[model samples]
Target: MKNTEQFIGKRVLVVGLAKSGMAAAGLLHRLGAEVIVNDARPLEGNEEAATLQALGIEVIGGGHPSDLLERGFDIIVKNPGIPYSNSLITQALERGLRIWTEVELAGLISEASIIAITGSNGKTTTTTLLYHMLNIGKKKPLIAGNIGTVACTVAEKAKNDEVMVLEASSFQLAGTENFKPHIAIFTNLYDAHLDYHGSTTEYLDAKLQVARNQTAEDFLIYNNDQEIVRSSVETMHAQKIPFSTEGKVVEGISADEEWIYWLGEPFISTKEIKLPGRHNLENILAATAAAILTGCKKTAIENVLSSFTGVRHRMQFVREFNGRTIYNDSKATNTLATKSAISSFKQPVILIAGGLERGHSFEELRPHMNNIRTVVAIGETAERFTEFAKSCGVEQSLLATTMEDAVKVAYESSSEDDVILLSPSCASWDQYPSFEIRGDQFIHAVMKL
Candidate 1:
C-alpha cells in the first residue's frame, strides 16, 4: 500500500458493518484515523463489532443514535448498499460533510494500477475474464469489488507490480469521489437499480463515475454500440477506446460474424470463444480491449476466451443429464438478463423463473419467448410469471414451491437435446438470502438428478 497521509489523524465515521465497512474501518484505524463504526444491528453477539472494538476502534450498534453526526467526523465512509435516502446519509449531506464508499479509500492507498469495470449486467463476467487474461499473460492481477472480495481489503495488500481489477456497481460508484481507475471498462448500460438510484439518469451517472476522475493518460474502454454509453464518454478526460460487438468501428475493438478486431486488425475468431450469448460476446470484447491496454498478448486472451464457459450462476453451464442440458443463471434477477439467457440457446427450453414481486411487468420478455417450451415458476412472482408465460403462448406453465421441485418439473418436461435453465427474472430475496444461495440450491438439485 502507498504511504498516504490523507487519513492521518482524521476523524472517520464508517456507516454499516458489512464486509466493506469493516475493512474500511480497519484500514482507516491503521492509517492513523480515529475511527468509529455505527451499524443498525444489535451489538450483542456481533462478531464484526467485537473484532473492530478489539482493534481499538469504537463500535456503536443496535441503531443509529440520533445525534451521532454531532460527534463531528471528518468524512463518512458508507457501505454502498446503504442508500442516500438513509437518515444519517441525508443529514451528512445537509451538514456538508464529504462521504465516500470504500472504493475511494482503495484508490487512495493502492500502489498498483486499477482496472475498474462497471455496467448494468456484465460487470462480474467482464471483471472475472479480464483478471484471468491478465493472470495468463503473467501480469499479477487481484480480483475485488462486487464480484465478492472487498476492494479496500485487496488494495491494502496489493503490490505496485500488481493490477487491481474491480467490479464496480452503481451504488458503490455513487459514493466515490476520487476513485479513478488506470483503465476503465463500461461494458454496457441498461435499466437497472432504479429503486436505489431513483431514476435512470441517476443510475447512469453513478456508473459513469468509474471514469469521471480519469485523466488523458488513463484509458476508458467503452461499449460503442450503446449510444448512451458512447455519448456519455465524449467529455471524459481519459483516452477513449471503443469496443463493439455489433459491427466494425473506425478504431479500437470491433467484432463481425467471424472475428474480433483490435484497431481494425483481426485478433481472434468468434468461433474460438466457448462462452455463449451475444451479451457475453459484448463482455468478451470489453475484457479483451482492457487486457490489450494492460499489454496482454493475443495468446493470453485467446486461451481464456476459447475455454472459459461462463461465470458461476451467470448463464453457467451445469451438466448434461438424461440427455438434457442444464444451465444455472440464478444471477438473472431482471427480465433483461433472462431475455439474454433465453436468447443464448436455440434448443427447446424448460425455464424455471420467478422471484420477488417488484411490481414490474415481465412484458419485456415476451418477444424472446419463442424457444420457451415450458415455464416452471417459483417464489413471490410465481403466479404472475406463470400467467405471463401462458400469455406468451408457452405451451406448458407450472408453478413449483421449491428449487428441487422446479428442477424436477423442468427436467421431466424436457426432451432429448432440450435445455433446462434456471433464469429467474426477479430478485432472489423472496426465498433465498442472495442470488448465490439461490443458484447453489439449483446446482445442488441438478447434481442430485
Candidate 2:
C-alpha cells in the first residue's frame, strides 16, 4: 500500500455498479474515504447496490443524477466500461473532477509490483501466462483487472512481496493518470473499440497511457513487429524491451520457427506450446519477455508453455465428433482475430461466424477465405457475413438463427480431419450477454453432437 492516509476523509464517487465499481466503492469506504456508489440499474433487484449500502456506503440506484457531479466529490472512481459519451462522465469532465479507473486506484495503494498487459487482443492469455510463470517461480502473484476480479479489490490484500498481473484494457487505461506498472506489456496493437473511443487516434492514445507514467527505472515490453505499436512509444523514457516474431532482436526476445531467443540465447521451443495461431506466437514472445525480466526461470516458462492448453473462448478446443475437431473461439470478436484463427489451421475449417454488427467490415478476413471450407453465419450480422463469404469464393455459406443450428450445419458439412471453428467476427450482444455465453452455447451444442 502506498499511502492509505491520503484517502482518509476524502469524498469519492464510484460510478457504475458493475464488479469494478462495487469493488472500488467498498475499498474506498474501508480506507476511510466517504464513498458514494451509483448505477443506472434501478433499485429493484439491484443486489450490487444492496451490498454497497450494507457496507455503510451511500448508494444511488435507478439512474445517474444530472447533479451528481455537483455534489463536490473530491475524486471519481469510474467503471471503465462506462463510455466517455455517457452523461455522467461528460458532467464529471466538465466539472474538472479527477477521474480514475479502478486500476489507477489500485496503483495508488498497491504495495505489490504490478505487471500490466494491454492490447486489442492477447491481453488475457499473456496476463494469465505471466501469472502462471510467476507462480512457477514461487512468487505470489495476484491476477486481476479486465479478466475478472477488480484490481483495487485484489490490491487491497496484496502483500509487498507479491506481484499483481493485470489484464488492462484501453477503456481502463483511458481514465488513468498516474498508473505506472513496474513491468508493462503491450502485446500488439490493432484498431479496435472505435465505437467507444470514436477514432483510431483516441484509441491509440488510451493504449499508450500504459507507458506514460513509467520512467527509465520501469520496463516496457512491447511488440516490435507492429509498426503502429513501435511508433507509438518512440519518445517514451521507460527501458524499452522489444519482442518480435517477425525477426530476431539483439537485446530482447525473438522467435524463430523452432525456438524463442531471449537476448540472443535460446529460450523455449515453439513446438511444445499447444495454443495455435501466429497471434499466440506473438503472445508467447511478449509473455516470455516479461517473465524473464521479472526473474522467472526458463524451466518454469517452458513448463507452463508446454502444459498450458489455452484460455477459454480463444481457440479453445471443444471436442472431436465425427472425425472433425471442434474449436470454440467466440472471443474472436473482430475481423483481425477471426483472420488469425483461420490462419492457424492448414486443415479445412467450417467457420461459424457473425454477431452484432459494429460497423466493421468483413473485408480484412477475405484473404483467409481460401482456408474456410464452409461458413455458418449467425446473429445480427449473419446476412452480411454470408454475403461476404460468398463473395470471397467460399463454396457454401449458410445462415443459422441460433448457435446450435450453426454448430449442426458446420458438423454436417465438415469433412474428416477438418476443423469446425466458432470464431464470430463481431460481438455477442445481439443474442447473448457476452462472448463467454456465446462460446458456452457453442460448446454445449458440440457436446450434444
1-449 per-residue lDDT for model 2 (tens digits): 66889899999998887888888888888889999988888888989888888878888888999888777899998889899999888888888889888998889999999999999889998988888888998888899998868999889889999999999999999989999999999988787789999999999899989999999999999989989999998888899999998788988899988888888888778888877788888888888888888898889988888877678998887777878988889999888889999999999999999999887788999888998989999999999899999999998999999988988898999899999999999999999999999999999999988
lDDT of each: 0.93, 0.89
Q: lDDT score of model 1?
A: 0.93
lDDT (10s digit) by residue, model 1, range 185-301: 998888878989999999999999999999999999999998999999999999999988878876889898899998988889999998888899999999999999999998999
Local lDDT at 301 for model 1: 95
What lDDT score goes with residue 413 in model 1? 86
> Candidate 2 — worst ten consecutive residues by lDDT sum?
267-276
**lDDT comparing candidate 2 with the true structure:** 0.89
Q: Which candidate is the best by lDDT?
A: 1
Off by over 4 Å in 2: 321-323, 357-360
Give the CA lDDT, 0 to 100, for residue 126 in model 1: 94
